[model samples]
Target: MDTLNSKKVTRRSFLKGAALLASIAVVPAAITSKDASAAAKATQAAMQYQDHPKGKLECSNCIQYIPGKTAKAKGTCKVVEGAISPQGYCLAYAPKA
Candidate 1:
C-alpha cells in the first residue's frame, strides 16, 4: 500500500488559499466599479452641465449622476466636475434604465 500523501492541505494552507481567491475576486470588482467614476470628469461647461433641468431631463434621472446624502441634495456626476444639482441637465446625460 502506498502511503505518500504529498497533496494534504493543512488548515493554515486552506485558509491562505481561500483568502487569496477572495482577494482576487474582490480586487477586480473594486477596479471595475470605479471605472465609471475614476476617469477624469469633464468640465461642466464642456458638457453643458446646467444647474437647472432641460425640460423633462435632469441629473437625478441620468445614469451618470451619483446621488447625494439626501433626495434633493446636490450630488456629483460621473462625467462632470464639482457639485451637481439634482435638477441639473447635461449634454452627457444618458437616461438610466
Candidate 2:
C-alpha cells in the first residue's frame, strides 16, 4: 500500500531502536566467559573427574586437556566444566599421542 511505503522511521525512533539493540548485545559479555562452556559440557562430578592423577595418567597427558595460558595454570577439559588441574584424571581420559 502507498500508506505503508510512504511511512518513514523518525530519527528518535531509529536511535531508540539502535540503543536497545546495542544494550542487548552488551548483555552477553556481562556474563562470565566460562558460563557458556559450563552449559555445554558435563559437570566434573558427572565425569568422575578428580584433582589427582590416576596412576601415571593425568589431564596434561590426555587428549581432551585444553591447556591454560601458562603451563602451571589450571586447564579445562573438552567434556567437563570448571578449572581442571593438570594433575586431574577422569573416565574420559584418552592418552595423547
Candidate 3:
C-alpha cells in the first residue's frame, strides 16, 4: 500500500515539473515571434528608402533620424541602416511631429 502511494506522488511531481518547463519554453518563443514580425516590418520599410530623394527633406528634420554620438560622425535613421547624413533624405522621410 505505501509503495503504491509513493509511486503515485512521484509520478504527479514529474508531470508538474514537465508542465512548468514547457510553459517556460513557450513564453520565450511567443515573445520572439512578436520581435521577428516587428523586425520584418522595419526591414520592408528600409528597402523602400534605397535612394535619398532630392529636395528640402533631410534626416535632421525627420522623425526616425538619430543624431551621431560625436559632432563629426554622421547620424542614423530608425528605418535606414548604416551611417546616415543629417542632410540626407530618403523615401522613409517623415517630418518631425
Over 10-96, each residue of candidate 1 has an lDDT whose tens digit, in order, gives 999999999999999998899887886666789989998889999999999999999999999999987899999999998999998
C-alpha local distance difference test of each model: 0.90, 0.91, 0.74
Model 1 lDDT, residue 31, Cα: 88
**TM-score per candidate, chains pooled:** 0.60, 0.61, 0.54
Span of ten consecutive residues with least summed lDDT in model 2: 29-38
* True lDDT of residue 39, candidate 2: 83
TM-score of 2: 0.61
Give the clashing pairs for model 2: none
* Model 3 error, position 29 (Å): 2.9
Candidate 3 lDDT over 4-86, as tens digits, reads: 76765578899999999999999999999988765643442455553354587777788988989875468777877677777
Instruction: Please list the residue runs of candidate 2 whose C-alpha ends up more than 4 Å from where it truly belongs after superposition.
Output: 1-38
Steric overlap count per candidate:
0, 0, 0
**Scored by Cα lDDT, where does model 1 land?**
0.90
Model 3 vs truth, CA RMSD? 4.6
**Which candidate achieves the best lDDT against the true structure?**
2
